[model samples]
Target chain A: MRSKRALRYGLLGLSAALIGVGLLRQEHLEVLGKAVRICLECVGIG
Target chain B: MSGMRRNRIKWPLSRQRTIQLISAALVNGYIAGFQKGRIFTGGTKAVCVPVLNCYSCPGALGACPIGALQTAVGGVKHHFPFYVLGLLMLFGVLLGRAVCGLLCPFGLVQDLLHKIPSPKVRVPKGLDRPARGIKYVVLLVFVILLPAFAVTETRVTPPYFCQYICPAGTLGGGIPLMLADPALRQLAGWLFNWKVLVLVVIAAASVLIHRPFCRYLCPLGAFYALFNRFSFFQMSLDAHKCVGCGACERVCPMAVEVTKDINSPECIRCGACQTACPTGAIAGPLKKQSPR
Candidate 1:
């Protein structure tokens, strides 16, 4: 039972880590670039 | 299927529902990404994820309530943000902090943290209740006063609650965004370091202490609490049916006094108390207060 719970959590953590990576990977670069541009603009520069 | 297997299947479905809500938050942040307008246009503008998520967080969909409140208060206009406040009140009256228990991405992080196979701490009633008031003070000073009078002109600012306090911002929006972008990495100055440190402390604390942020510094929780008494969705305890056995209280994750005030602000409406009651004294919207 305890090992089952561990496996469940392990899967969940793995998925979140994957999503986090996916969010940063090649597909999400446009959003990342835009967000960076906005943050820089907020601080008064390019 | 056997009873145990049925229960096991149900648990994963429930967790999936929670994941769906986190996706909804992310989608909302994506939609609201275009706007970061000035103070007169209701200064703070990030959509609040129930558990006091930060407005400046990278993936945040809408204006954070606490940040909005602080910016509105601190803005030269110095009037309450009627639109934001009204929207928050409506949500509170409808759902209470069920948003925290089920929907918040940050709350999801804490739930994940609690699963880390560590010693968990249950705060004693003597200490927990008083400590819960800290968010109110944060709302008063950081969200309200500091932004209202702190500056001479209406300089738009992220509320201090978000800048210094929110772990949700740290986890959901901050770390993820920084991890994705290298330029954001270069800009990681003293303030960013401070934010990360605060996030680390909160993340570590969440492992031992169940939702220390929700208990202590979530201004959104504080706001929802104001409407808990009058919220359309509420928990009711029948005095005649309840034997005053401490079962409901013991089951409550948020440590609400279920018998005395089932609708207390601290009650996240997790439905644990309803399930815990052997006599079935506690009832929800579908059930009667007295069980007829």
Candidate 2:
């Protein structure tokens, strides 16, 4: 039970840290730029 | 064979089903864009949702984690997808495939279609076990490998999964855009036709099989399955309450052996097993505990 909880919260912490790294790097802006455009490929045009 | 799978319940709108509908609505909340034939271009669009909703869907308020991952992987400017991967990891750590069972719009579509009352088909375990691995293959080959390594003639990396395979793209993104704009219809070609064919097959298959796409093709579900075993909200089976009645296994949509492995990756956390367990052996945080 202890190990399980540790693994669960450990991964959660790692996820939060990665998100911080991503934001500091402005990777969300890249997602924003792609998402704002009507991705024709996603519309099955490609 | 699936006579008492889930349709017969204490209430018409079960808690999971209600959450599914509400999540779908909230994920695709920009309803005006659906009529206007335009995608939402707001700050919220940067945020990634945990489901397989297509970003091209006119009403989508946020990007799909899978789609955003592929886009970032395929981007020339953005070499790595820290944001999308982080978001996906966060969702998986939190809920695992409960996101599929309780939140995915495409999962809701499959569940509704599977309710159409037909002779259900269950694939033999010999084939089904092998078939389940296809989604992981899709995640590796289409979502990751092709985007990161396979360069097109123009030196641009295409999101191969969305362009060539995603049926959600056809139903939620392609069809609506085609209906809304003449130019998009004119633009539709062999790829669009292929997508429609894929959608039709999945739709027909859904009537006879529960979540064939999620079980066999959804890369998003595959990604979440990795975290299912240790995810925070996984169901716990009470050995003391279990009478080995085998009720839970029979109703499992994913064919999981509920008594043996209630927290299996294939178990969508849809509560069918919990509902079917006569002794209430299979209870989760979502379920009420019986007094000892």
Candidate 3:
């Protein structure tokens, strides 16, 4: 039981750390760039 | 009238249904975009919502995570999808398939459709078990592999799931945009027809079966399912309180074996099992219980 709790919090910390690194690298800018446009494919025009 | 009563949705609707409606509305909150037939171009577009919404939905306030993941990974630069994966992981660790049960817009659509009073078709356990595995394969092949490696002549890979499958996009983004814009209608082709067909089949299937897409093909659900066993929000069965009546199994929409595997990867944390259990042995998806 203690191990399970440790594993859960361990993953939480890992994900938060990953997010921090991604922000430092500006990876969200890539997501924003693609998202701000009208994605014709998502509209089923592809 | 009888059918409505049978579904027990005639009165003040359930808490989960209300949350689903509110969440769907807020997630697609740029209402003026629907009127003008244009996608939202705000900074919030950079953020990804946990549920499987469409970036092309004119009213979408945020990017679809799966779409963002595909685009970020499939780009010529291909620096890896750390941000998207982190966000998805965070959501999974927090809510697991409770996101599917109480938050996903497409999940809400299926729930409403299934309430249409048609004859329910119970998928055989043998077939159902295998079919459930297809969503993981979809996550591996379409959302991950194809997007990462299937580069086109144009030097980019398409979001295969969004383009080829994903009835949510076809319904929420494609059809609405197609309906509101006459000029865009001229561009409709075989692909558009194919997407519309996919939406039709899924919608039709929802009337007879519960969450066929979530069970068999949703890559987001597949991704989240991996974290279900340890997600903060979950269902718990009290073996001490349980009488092994099997009532929970009979009522489960996703066909989970509640007594043995209440936190199974397929369990959506919908709490129907909790509601169905006669012995008060089941706990919540949201309620925190001390480790027993």
Ranking by lDDT: 2, 3, 1
Candidate 3 interface RMS: 0.8
- Model 1 agreement with the true structure over B94-187: per-residue lDDT tens digits: 6677766666666666656655656667887788889999988877777777766667543654456656666665655556556665676677
Off by more than 4 A, model 2:
B1-11
- Per-residue CA lDDT of model 3 for A1-46, tens digit only, reads 7887888899999889888888888988888988888777887898
* Top-DockQ structure, candidate number: 2
**Could you give candidate 3's per-residue lDDT for residues B94-120 as a string of tens digits?**
999999999999999999888887668
CA lDDT, candidate 1, residue B43 = 17
Model 2's DockQ? 0.87
Model 1 / residue B60 / CA error / Å: 3.7
The reply for model 1, stretches above 4 Å from the true place, is A1-46, B1-10, B13-51, B55-59, B76-78, B152-158, B285-292
DockQ, candidate 1, vs. native dimer: 0.02
lDDT of 2 by residue, B1-292 (tens): 3353434333578888899989999999999988999889999988999999998899999997888998888887637777788899999999999998999999999999888756688888999999999999999999999998887676668899998889998899899989999999998999889889999999999888889999999999999999999998789888998889898887788999888888899988899888877877777757864555
DockQ of each: 0.02, 0.87, 0.81
Chain A of candidate 2 scores what in TM-score?
Answer: 0.95
